[model samples]
Target: MDNIAGFIFLCGLVLVSATQPQDEILNNFQQVTKLSHLGLEFADFFQNVTLSDISLADSRAPNEEDLLCLRDLTLFSNALKERKLWALKMIDAWGSIPSGILTGNRHNLGNYDECLNINKDISQGVTIRGKYCFLQTSLSAMLGSDIGALGVVTRIKTATCFPASCSAAHMNLFVSQVLQKVLNLDIPSTAMGISDASCQTSASEPWDGLTIFTVVLLSLMGAIVAVFTVYDYFFCKNHNELPAIVKAFSARANSRALFRIVENTSNPNVISCLNGIRCMSLFWVVFSHEYTGRFFAANLNLFNVLPWSKLPFASFILHGFFSVDSFFFLGGLLLALIALRTMDRTKGKLNVPLMYLHRLIRIVPILAVAILVYTKLMTVVANGPLLQGFSGETACETGWYWTLLFVNNYTNVKCLGHTWYLSVDMQLFIISPVLLIALYKWGKKAAAGIFVLIVLLSGCLFATMMVNNYSMMFFQNSFSIDAMSNMYFATHTHATPWLIGFLFGYFLHLNKGKKFQLSWISVWSGWILCLAMIFTSIFALYPSTQSNTPPLTTLEESFYYTLTRVGWPLALCWVVFACMQGYGGMANSFLSSPLWQPLSRLSYSIYMWHLFIQEMNAKSSRTNSYFSDYQLMLQFWSDIGITLVVAYLLYLIIEAPIGGLDNFLRPQKKPAGVQKTSSYPIQIVSDQKVHGDGPSKLKETETIAQTISE
Candidate 1:
């Protein structure tokens, strides 16, 4: 009995695999047949109707063959109509036939028109004689065998029922004829199919795609890699390595932390704009990295033809996050203006220590918390390796120390590779002030000329890199090169575009008296051009395709590398100029919203922390089966959420407190221009009379400086 049961089970598997259901095929046939009939009927209906009849000139002529085809299609309609009726009638007598009988083969019943007629007559023999027709019988007889599927018919009489017509209907008739020749039209006669019956004795089985052992091994390997990656991201191997991070987040918050910058002003515009740009840019960075990383890992060639194959731009319309040079340029400009203003107002004697102290106060607390949280999650929670798999690449991984120290400018550290723009900006922080001091003394024209030269130099350098096909360096190098030679992009390479922003700011400040011409045409045109530049960058740049090497087409290569980096920046600069000129209307309403403020506030922390979160999520996905399909999207959003939470938390706990500590560490000192005044209210007189001086000559300068700083 057991042997018999096993044999039956094997037989059942074979029967199931050998055939597909008849209902699905029948439904498809009916659908296609109906559509063909509908097309034919519409043609006939329009034959007698003219455009003039409906007050519109009908340009297309109705095809006669279309009418004939519709008439012939009625045969299948009639057959289907009969089948439905027969099934209803046969319901009472069901199961009289063998239980295992197959029904799929009976589809051939529609093959002959005469056969159908005969069957109809047989079924209705002495009951009644009724005319069976659909559409028009006369029209049906005109098209011989061209109405429906030809293979469906078994005899000449059936074929004669529908013939092809030679008119506007030729297209439909041609399609109908081809379909008829392709379909199966036979009914099953056997109690069981030969293949299904054979399964009882000789069962069949499908080959397995993978063995159990192999699956287990793969799972194990995945777990190990995930574990290692989680460990690396969270734990600093040594205290000395991350002291600033520890101190900032520690219960006893300290003054010395990472990312310090000083400025002595409460200017809302400077602060708000910088913060907003940072947050928005970081979001863009995360999106680009997450999407692009997945795309490359999957080895998709969706945009193989396009050169600018990467994130944001290649993925969709809003993907221009990959084109994040806009933020860097903005920061550079703001920094330059602030620096220049300080110099001019202070009679060329800017307090460097005060500036550094202020910056340190703002930056360190947030930096510390970010490092701590990221380190904890990566090390303790995830157990991932530091730098993940980047341990092997000496050139690339060597920059991690520099990154932590925020000395990436000197060491070229790029722990968060995509975040190199931050490092570049930090380096700019040191250099821009000095440059601003020079601009105040040397004049705006000279400064602008120097900026132009730098831009040209950047362009030339990009040209050289592309010419040599430095694919590895282009993609891999994070932060060692001078701002001019940063390989990843044309904009953030060193401080090249930053310099442009600085110069623009300087010039804008120097020529402060000129009224901005907010002519509607120029404003709208500038806005339109900014939009066009963004779109062009997307279409022309962001997609990446697998190539043994980068393409060598000079025209294609030069165009993308230069235009996306160079042209887009200039276009953006123009946009900024326009906005400054008017600073109102739709553009202002959009940019100055309450929503933008928070994003700007958290932008820096988000930038610092997002990548570590993304790495964690990516590892988590491998372990969790639920995210198998939507891993990429999940990881992207997860990174964003984590970054926000972490940033806000750090902002409150570390950033806010660090400000106080920073102030304590470096107490506010006297301004360079301040001098000791006479202590007595009754000052000894000049020429034997009490003489009093008005407000210090430095009042206006101090006011302006204070305003600019704020």
Candidate 2:
């Protein structure tokens, strides 16, 4: 016992002795970097500092004592001192103590306005010529607390005023040196260094090559629009001959097409409820994105926001990711319905290449325009402390081609991250023709095989979840990019919902114009079950958000994720099926209303533009915003209003004109004997055998292209 006690005491003594040098080095660093010492030095310098004195030609240099102090501070570790000597010298020569070092806190940002105000006040008696820089660092989370761990303050936004001679590169190098030398740790290069791009100085920045290119491209587009709009008014409207290109870009003609709403009362096969569903789903997405922006923004009361996530009513916001699945379902339904109908009319001679081309033309142009605007123009239009952090310019610049190719879900770059849905949707569309053709040739057997394939895909998703230990809840503390890329963003993992919609589409096609009489109890029961499934899918993970509740096991998470992915679509399937069959009652009347038509027409444009708008709003903030339900709703409505106006303009300038061109280029030929009864352009004639039975015929009618377009 005496030997054991002596040994323990000796080990403690050895540990304390070893820590003393590290403690001394840290203390020296703190003394050198402390706010009070730096403030006194800055005050003394300010008394003698003048515009000409601090000019690039004649900037003040570091004092000999300060340089010696830094050298002596690191002398205990010969290797560290030798390696960091240049960094220390550069920092001492060029760096100023950042204003955020004094005024910033974990809960609030440093006073950005005050920092600039101080610089302005200091230059009052002299020729105002100092540079104020916004230095951003990515290591704020290393502060070590629950708040830091949650990544609520993942970045440190600090300001520093330096002489015009202290270039942005010098300031960035200074910050990097201070962090590296003081932390005394080998931080990852990506995480510690402040890049030149991340530093914003008050100096007027010159236009870079990309910015100049963007300007030229936009000017050319504008010139084209102006020329075409003028040409369209005088020539196309007066019955004069014009080329297809002139007619395609006519704003006058496109606006008429955009505002015109045709109700297909005669076409009972049209799914009218889909318009409301689409518009509502898009609004939900915008609302969710607003919350996401707030969550990521510099919020003063981020801890308050976390508690709201636990509220029962907040499940709608928390689980709004499922809103994306709604689009997946709709995409599959429309593709299957249209493709199957076209195949039936053409006797399985569908033009697959043209179909793909048509889809690309419809989607890619607007997406490209959006990507260009986000990457090149956003920084030019907005400047603030947070702009560089969330602008995603770097990602978009490097990986935009992947996004354009509709394969960015697999890429690490998350340029316009929400666009992953488009990739998944496009990937699904590419493979859909195979299934459509198989269904046309083999009917129920193909569907049965496809169902089995969906199950297998779900199994793969479950296996992925188990291997990675991903949580079912998306907004959890442990949620990561890996979880999103593998499951939420992956085409295979999302195939079940989309394929389920395809099956529902097939079901709808088989029973089109057929009526089923059911007892009132049976109809009510179906509605109840459908509503229950949807509510369950949304609210089932609420418990996981609560502090008192234990985390879900891997088995539980996998099961919930797999089941909800399937169940959410199944519920939506019932709503569409019932509404089409006239059993939807009041629900049908509300969903099939004409009010949803205009908004639904703009749904695609709204989805493309809403996030961009939200990003601009969040990043343009000059100070930390307070998070609240009312504030979020206010922002959401404001975003929606701006989005509506932008979406309409986009439709007028791009989507509608492109759509008109698509129609003009691919004109549908009228059958020789058939008379035109409606103004709608495209028509399909369906007369095919069902299950190898006798031919089942329906009158030649207009295709629900507009309905599918929504």
Candidate 3:
């Protein structure tokens, strides 16, 4: 009769698997089976096992997939309660009773997977916990309620199995066998997956004592600044005693400044083409970071959904990386142009110290403020599964000095990850004075030698990177952070564009005001070649950006990295040269448009805060899933809008005020004997008045033109 019953139970198991629709849980178990190597009938083994021994450990009651895991665990554990032979079968299948848990340093034993907190949760507070992630919640406590696991054997050698030692041999055999078999059956992996699932919490950590304190301090300071700014802007009547705050953010003053910035041909010493290029580059950066900024966000499954090679025409967005080169190119160009002009004005001499000081003054104040806010604010306002250990204060606070010192690119420490650009640019500025002085004093022979040296150094560096298989990316393209630290972010490797910019700037400086007479074909061809170089540089990495395509070979990577970095900057020089020489047609007009002036003014501040806004958006995301293009675009726009407001505030309070404070506080120096004709990188002036004591005010453009006169 017992044999018939067992045979009938076996038939029921076969019938269920054969007739029922395939369950996803069962599929998971099957997938995990490859790791188990257990040779047994899953249906028969499940029939004997039950889940009554389950404990969510300290985890809250399970939900969705987690609930399914607990349900399955209970089913397997319960089956072992009645079937003695099944326990031996499980022992044979798993090889032995599994020990330990899947927490740190114990993911695997010699041959079997561990059954982490199942036995221990009975004594802990294993109640039915609701689903709310605490800042310090343990992984074991999130799966469900646990009474102790049911005893598998009532007696061993006719003694009661009360304290569990009497049936130690059988219980160890049965429990270990059951746990091992269950882990083999897909329970441990499922339970372990709790670590990967998206988690969120609305409640703030009270232990964030420092965050609260910082917020209060910042609030008080902000209120004081705000009140003072308002009073100075509206209430202060005397121009002689004008506060810098009124001069910086005052609506009446800034309105006139904005108008001057947008006036076509207003103070045309600076190439208006730069306005468009800077603005466009900044927008591209925002667009690119729209997707890449989720370094720690939910998977967003972009590689799967938006595979790179498969796209028909919009791959340029992926290559927004070229924009950084454009910036570097522009930096080198401006540095060479201004340095040469300053030396020419100063009798072939440069103020190396003042040049350095001016650059530091331009870049550091806003940077320091942004870092301070990012480190302190993130802990209070945001927290998410992806941001668990990466975002906010911990990512950057210790390394503020490295960034301030302009050596951040060489260090593994990062306060704001994006600040690597600031470090690189600052370092380039520090070094540029030496090169500028050399070129000014030494002439063309020096230029030729330096040019050749640059080519050789760039070539050699790229070759080494490719040979070492440096990932060449701060993103998925990199193999390791160590490699990215040494290769991608290094000043030496990225200096190619900066160096090239100097050459272009020198060329433009020498040829300024010279009219060129070229045939129509020559003009057209120059434009074509320029366009081709840019398009090719931007799109060169299209094939490698996707997951399906194989990684670029060392030769291919070396060639493109070498060519593109050189090509993009050279193309920029052409645009500037052609425009100045009256050869640039539509490209120059569009680039030189006054519409870009305001955006250009905001570009640096925008770049600084765009990533911070992106992180905030990602952490606060309502959907804990892969990002789709539609979703990203919407957030991208939202991020831009918010960033603009924040950037404007930063510019008013910290950035624009730097020059104003100096102008307002110090005794105005009389026009330092006809200063050289050069475009200041940041110059917002009124039609008649320059800010404070700026460039003799109403006569600024005439003065600039006169200073450059031969």
In order, candidate lDDTs are 0.40, 0.61, 0.53
The deviation in Å at residue 646 for candidate 2 is 2.0
Which whole-number lDDT from 0 to 100 does residue 125 have in model 1? Answer: 29
What's the candidate order when arranged by decreasing TM-score?
A: 2, 3, 1
Model 1 residue 652 CA deviation in Å: 2.2
Worst 10 residues of 1 by lDDT: 690-699
Off by over 4 Å in 1: 1-279, 293-323, 364-377, 383-400, 405-413, 471-486, 489-492, 511-514, 541-552, 622-635, 665-710
Which of the predicted structures, 1 or 3, would earn the higher TM-score when compared with the native? 3
Instruction: For each of the candidates, give the backbone clash count.
Output: 63, 0, 26
User: Can you give the TM-score per candidate against the true fold?
Assistant: 0.49, 0.76, 0.68
Per-candidate RMSD, Å: 25.5, 11.0, 13.7
Q: What does candidate 1's lDDT look like per residue over 459-479, in tens digits? A: 775676566554321332221
User: In lDDT terms, how accurate is model 2?
Assistant: 0.61
lDDT of 3 by residue, 434-469 (tens): 777678878787678769967986787777777787
Sliding window of 10 residues with minimal summed lDDT for model 2 = 688-697
